[model samples]
Target: MAVEVKNSESQAKKRAFLTPKRILIVVGVVLALGVVGAIALNQLSKNPAFCGTCHIIKPYYESWKNSNLLANKHAAQGVECLDCHHKSYLEKAQEGINYITGNYSEPLEKLTFTREQCLECHEEDYEQAVAATEFEESNPHDSHMGEIECTQCHQMHDKSKVMCSQCHTFSWFEELDDSWEIES
Candidate 1:
């Protein structure tokens, strides 16, 4: 009877160490912590100041501060850096590695934004923008230029130019103070 009691106690101790409930509790805690950490890091990365930490991005941050470009205007309107600069976790990780290792391009390539992305926010204003400028010459938005990329002339941080000026001379275009003036 004494031997049986000892064996049962030893079995109970072994079972206690490997209990399914205890293992599940540990896993749950780990997953919860991971979720919270990921959320915190993601929020931290979204700050414009955080982006400014990268040397390559400092110029962009400064330009955004000094220029009255769309990016800066958007920031003023409460849009955050990541609102337009979103990338997948894997892509961000790869870029981070390249930046840390000094393997990035000298002039970091500009992020290309799709027309759809712009339209997502500006769809309602598209017609108004096209109609705002009433030059006898065809409205750029309604004409051939409509098919071209918005960024071709609508720089976000720097002074926007009339891309058509490369081929054609529209004196009125030169008279415009800024690209945003087209809407005025």
Candidate 2:
């Protein structure tokens, strides 16, 4: 009788230990999977190809193909999509939330770069772009004083500005396909 009771107690101890071991194995597997998934996602986001994988971004990519910035070669060489778009921690958080919620159809304005966003690198030009035309120009000031945001003249999405012909009496865009052909 005594021997049977001791063996029963030993079996109960083993059962208790097995439960914790199973729990630990499950937790470890879950953590490992999470790490692997995070690494894969980080790599995908870095690829420009990954950005264009979505159908919604096709227009943006096509616009970039025709942009002056693409012809610039210098700016295109250094600046990636992230350079202007993901400048702030808050912006990163916003992006994460958008991904988490699977809301890919947000307004283009929200995702598009603003004049303020580009100022991170173009610090010198920020004042000239935002400042009144009087103080900004070196030539004898003759034009009307219009305080314009960088985006006013230049379309932030394409990094292109209006043609001189758009405001003037010339049809420069008839043959020359410049970045911005003046929005109609």
Candidate 3:
């Protein structure tokens, strides 16, 4: 009977430590910490300085600094690095692992942006941009060439170019050059 009492006392003591209230408090603390840590990491990763940590990204950072491209303008306007360079957390984690292992590709492949991505922010000005560049021979934004990717001519961190010049000639090219230079 005494041994049974002792065992019961020990069990009660153990249960005291893991009472429902205590368990709830511990879980709440852990969840709060997890939320805070995730928020901190996300903010840190969104910083442009964070992107510059990789040596291969230096050229892009420098170009963003000097270029009159939309990316630079957006940066100046307080857009975060991740706003455009968004990746899933898993993808980002894998990339981080690859970078640490020196398994990433050399010459760091250029990041690509889709027209839809650009349109998200520029949708209001899409028509205006197209109209501004409209030429008698072709409406660069509304013609068959419109199907071409925005990145083909609209470099984000470098001098934008007219990819059409490689395959076609137009008098408007000179006008575009003059206007772009003036805008710069």
Candidate 4:
């Protein structure tokens, strides 16, 4: 009976060592980590630093710092870099392509903002601005630069909107048109 008991104990140990359950548990852990790693990699691309990695975006980073919209502490507090820039996975992918191809390069210019991009958060603001009867009549920016993109003037990170007077005094234009007079 003692010998029989010893043989049974050894058999039990061998079975436990090779069990399917143990193997499955180990595989599950590895697969879970792989899934998590993939997600992390995807998120990394959306980071503002990641966007700045491309030489094309470096200028945008600098200009955004000086913009009026970016300087607005209230907007900056609630809407972070990703909130305005990386709203969706599709946008992230598009950004990657844009960075590589240098497409839409001019929007990075100081005192500019992408109206479509800004409309995402300021939907009501955009609607009001667009629908206003003054949109055509008193739109100072439109008269000067044709139609301006909101993002072209507004920076996402710094949230600054460059005023016309920053570079060109109202008098400069007023010299050309009496209506360009400075307003108090």
Candidate 5:
């Protein structure tokens, strides 16, 4: 009877605690949880408010709230930060790491988008935008400067300035655009 008890105890000890089936189940559950967490984070971060959570974004976020800049107009038409930012996930991750490591510059640089990006919602193409605004005298879209950048005239966070105003003596304020001479 003593020999039988010792043999049974040894057999119990030899039995593996984590079988291959149990390992697979644990791995599957962890992967599922990770996927769900990632989805939740992505959805929550889509709102511009999420960008405002960071201290560095305070100025831009505040501008969006009360300022009558182009940003507010875009927001009114259902455009969000990510829509214009268009930064890749990897680039955004690196930006966060740089912020954490204090390896970034102050007075955050203004982000620029391609002409195609602007035309995405504003018009069908650059020519279309030009035609729409040609009713104005100067026709900023059809400039002699040859392919003027939209950002040069249409700032979102700061005051917008007409590029032509730099060279021509246009009677306008700092926040003026092509439609400065609207005949009321």
Candidate 6:
């Protein structure tokens, strides 16, 4: 009887090392904490301040905050960096890796958006945009040179200019809304 009781006690000790329930609970807790941490990091990274943390991105961030370019104007109207520069989770993660590894191009590549991308938040199409500027002396939206890319005249980082001013002088551009700058 004593021997049988000793064997039973030793077996119980071995089984108590980790029951199935305990292992499942531990895994669940770890996964939950990981998810919570990821969520917190993602939310915190969305701020302009976070992007400014990267030395290469500091100039862009500053332009967005202080310049009269479309970046500052858009930020004033409550638009954020990620709002237009949408990227998937994997893409963002890859960008982070590249930033850390110093494997990115110098003077980060400029992003050019299409008319459709512009229309995502804009209520006006090309014709509507032309109509909106009809009161002005010249209609840049309806260029005789064919449909122009919005980014040509509506630069976000650097100063924006009147595309038509390359040859034609729309002197009223500067006085219009301070939106377009004189070409250098």
All models, RMSD in angstroms: 6.7, 6.8, 6.5, 10.1, 6.2, 5.4
> C-alpha displacement of 47 in model 6, angstroms?
1.8
lDDT of 6 by residue, 57-123 (tens): 9999998888877899899999989999897878877888999999999899998998778878884
lDDT of 5: 0.73
Residue 2, candidate 2: how far off, in angstroms?
Answer: 28
Best by lDDT: 6
| Better by TM-score, candidate 5 or 4 | 5
Model 2 TM-score (2 dp):
0.57
Which residue ranges in model 5 land beyond 4 Å of their true spot?
Answer: 1-22, 100-103, 124-137, 172-184
lDDT of 2 by residue, 98-141 (tens): 76677766435444445565567667755563353333222111
Residue ranges of candidate 6 with Cα displaced over 4 Å: 1-33, 125-129, 135-137, 174-181
Over 1-184, each residue of candidate 3 has an lDDT whose tens digit, in order, gives 9999999999999998999999999999999999898788767777787777888776676555555675677778877667788789888778778888998777888788888998988887888988887778877677575477777777777667776766777777777532132221
Estimated TM-score for each candidate: 0.70, 0.57, 0.67, 0.41, 0.70, 0.75
What is the Å distance of residue 146 in model 1 from its true position? 5.3
Where does candidate 6 clash, by residue pair?
none
* Residue pairs clashing, model 1: none
What does candidate 5's lDDT look like per residue over 1-184, in tens digits? 9999999888876666567888899999999998898678677778899888878887787677656777776677777888878777678768778878987778787677766667676666567867766643467788889886677677777776666766775343433553233232
Candidate 4 lDDT tens digits, 1-184? 9999999999999998979999899899999998897688687865656655777666554444444434334334554455554447566667667766777655464434466666666778665755552432344445467667765544444433335655544433343322122333
Worst 10 residues of 3 by lDDT: 175-184
- Best by the TM-score measure: 6
lDDT of 1 by residue, 91-121 (tens): 7778778989999897988778877888887
Q: What C-alpha lDDT do the candidate models reach, one value each?
A: 0.76, 0.55, 0.75, 0.56, 0.73, 0.83
The clash count of every prediction, one per candidate, is 0, 0, 0, 22, 0, 0
Instruction: Give the true-structure RMSD of model 5.
Output: 6.2
**Residue pairs in candidate 2 whose N, alpha carbon or C atoms collide under 3 angstroms:** none
**Can you tell me which runs of candidate 1 are displaced by over 4 Å?**
1-37, 178-184
Candidate 5 TM-score, C-alpha based:
0.70
For candidate 5, the clash count comes to: 0
